[model samples]
Target: MAEQTLKEKTAKGLFWGSINGGIQQILNVVFGIFLARLLSPGDYGLIGMLGIFMGVATVLQDSGFSTALINRKGIKHEDYNSVFWFSFSVGLICYVILFFCAPLIADFFGHPELTNLSRVLFLWFLIGSTSIAHSAMMTKKLMVKERTKIEVSAMIASGIVGVVLAYKGYAYWGIAIQTVTNAFVGAVLRWYYVKWRPTFTFALRPLKEMCSFGVKILFTSIFAQINANIFAVLLGRFYKEDQVGYYTQGNKWMNMGYTFIWGMIGNVSLPVLSEVALDVKRQRQVFRKMLRFVSFISFPAMFGLALVAPELIVIGVSDKWLPCVPVMQLLCIWGAVTPINNLYIHVLLSQGKSNIYLYNTIALGVVQLLVVVSMLSLGIYYMVLAFVVVNVLWIFIWHYFVNKYVEISILDVAKDILSFCLISLIVLCITYFVTKLIFNIYMLFIAKVLLATFLYTFVMYLSGSVTFKESFTFLLKRK
Candidate 1:
């Protein structure tokens, strides 16, 4: 009965998580199209230059307490209260420091205009901090439905703000304000939906108790953020803003593609896996199931995006953004495997292996930084190629540590995802060839999308893919 209850919760979480990710991405693409059409790559590159700073600040503000809170058994109001105050305090500190250091950041990137941009952008750190505990509470309770409402409402409100600003010729400021607005609105809605309030009885004891676990997560997240944005930092330092913009634009689409898959897995993976942490066999079973599900969605989605990159970019944003096409295609390769890596990390975190998580992530980050730096003189494409290759290969390293806790070998891992990966590759290749002769970009884009979807579905059905069938049936039942 307990297992059945967990299964139900997991299913519901996935359902709402899907809704959240799907709607969020749709809004992202819609608003993104308008902004991309209105703004230049240099505009986006300027904002992208600060990606590392914002990413690191946000990680430091949250301090991983949200994950720690969720993983802790029998969590209390005091735990949530402690995290809330701590997060807000850290956020304020981060914002103030960044505000003062904005000039230094601008100087580092050789962009004098970044001083004001960084200051305004840093506000999101403070605004987003106020909601960490509330957001964590929703995740802990598997209130994905409520969380979905908050996120979608926030996106819609912010999207409008961003589009209007861009349409009025605000340039990069539009993107910056859009980001800050999303955080502000989401924070407000989180508090509204999550009735849990932090008490005045903030205590050091609870913070200290969760610190060991949370700190490791904090460092891990910090390293991961750095790795993710290192490219932007390097490109900004060594190349033109427009070059950085191209990479940024491409990466944005790639991120959206995989985020749709990982977002759903993320909402349920940790909490659900934490539930079965003590049962190694059961944990492995659950982990493998999620692995299959992510693979089923991630491969075709990302690869298909790669297949239609030329047409999609041209049709969606126009020829001015065409430079990002190859970049987007390369990044899609890494995007496809990212969710599987995330699942492996969750398994380690679920079993209280924060140390392992920290060390592994730090190692990956260091190697990625070194690889990108080594390929620096070669150009952005080489840098991106190296980045993608290293990340995709790092799965084995993750699997190595995950095996310690879950007893699932690399072969077991491959068995779950490899076929899906190969099938997606073959199907997309065929779709590309079939659609290659179409001269009209619009027609080619539509043809590639439709044909790929049909072929992938037909193959999944023919091959008796349980993940495919289960997902289809689940959506049908929900509808």
Candidate 2:
């Protein structure tokens, strides 16, 4: 019964989180469509170059304290207070370090402008630190419903601020301003929504324990970011900023394909799984349900997007951005594999298995870092191809890890994947014929997407992936 309650709560949280994340993602898509038109790809590339340093600096600020906070049980107000101070202090330290080392960071990326760009962007860490406590506290309390709403509102507000500023020609600062404003708004709103306050004091002893766990997690975070941000780093150093912009645009839309799925899984699943850590039967039920929900939608979206990447980018972004088309397709395929991989991370954390996660992450991170570095010699096309290869490896490693924890069969995973790919094929066929008949890139893109979406949903309904009555009833009342 307690397990069931946790599932229901998780569902509620995911429903709300998805709504919030969905709105925010849509705004991002809208902005990318607009910003891609307004700014040169070189503009995006410059920011992308600095982003590598920024990513490392930001990770240093939190170092897994937040993740450790979530995994640690029975945390008190004092613990929270200590965490707040520790994270804040780390932010200050990181800011100082980044400020001092800005020139070196610029040198690493081989771009002189990266120094000032990085120094200005380093302020984000400070801004980000303010809200870590509030945000983590929300996760600790499984307050996803409130978390989602506040974040969504901040997202919309930030998008508005960014677009207006970009149009005014602040260049990269336009993007930076939006980021800073979004953090400020999100922190204020998250605190307002949660109403938890901390005096900025640290308990020397408990702070040590929190830092111990957090430091390990911090390494994990850095490893993960290194792999994810490599493209931007490599693009900036080797390719033109315009090319970086193309990649950025491609990456943006590719990520959009996963937002709702991520919403339902990562945002909601951890707290849900954590709440019932001891109950294997119930944990499995919740995990499976979450997996099913994510897979159904995410699978088809990425598949269809891959087929139409060329058309989608050409229409949404100008001809200048068309270089992203193939990279987009490669990344869209990468996107499809994430739902299952992400589920493993959440389940591991919930079961007090973060050490396993840390180990797996380290191994994978080393491999990816080397892989990405090796590919830098091969140019951007193969660099994108490296992503596809790494994704395949990731799926294998995750399954290898999960084998001990759950009984998920290879066949089961394959069945879900194959079905999704098949549906994608059906959609592609429809789009191909319709595209041939119509011949307008705009219509082909939109028509293919809509037709794919409709056909996938229809086929899923007919195949009992979900039922009409069940889905409608589920939607009608948020059951």
**Model 2: per-residue lDDT, tens digit, 292-374?**
66666676777777877888777777787788788888887778778778887888777666677788888887777787778
Per-residue alpha-carbon lDDT of model 1 for 1-479, expressed as tens digits?
99999988999999999999999999989998999999999999999999999999999988989999999888888999999999999999999999999999889989999999999988988999999999888888899999889989999999999999999999999999999999999999998988888878788888899999999999999999999899899899999999999999999998888888888879899999999999999999999999999999999999999989988898889999999999999999999999999999899999999999999999999899899899999999999999999999999998989998799988888899999999999999999888889999889988999999999999999999999999999999998
TM-score of 2: 0.93
Candidate 1's error at 285, in angstroms? 0.5
Maximum-lDDT candidate: 1
Which residue segments of model 1 deviate by more than 4 Å?
Answer: none
Judged by TM-score, which candidate is best?
1
RMSD of each: 0.9, 2.2
Q: Residue 387 in model 1: shift from native, Å?
A: 0.6
Worst lDDT run of 10 residues, candidate 1, spans 193-202
* CA lDDT of every candidate: 0.92, 0.75
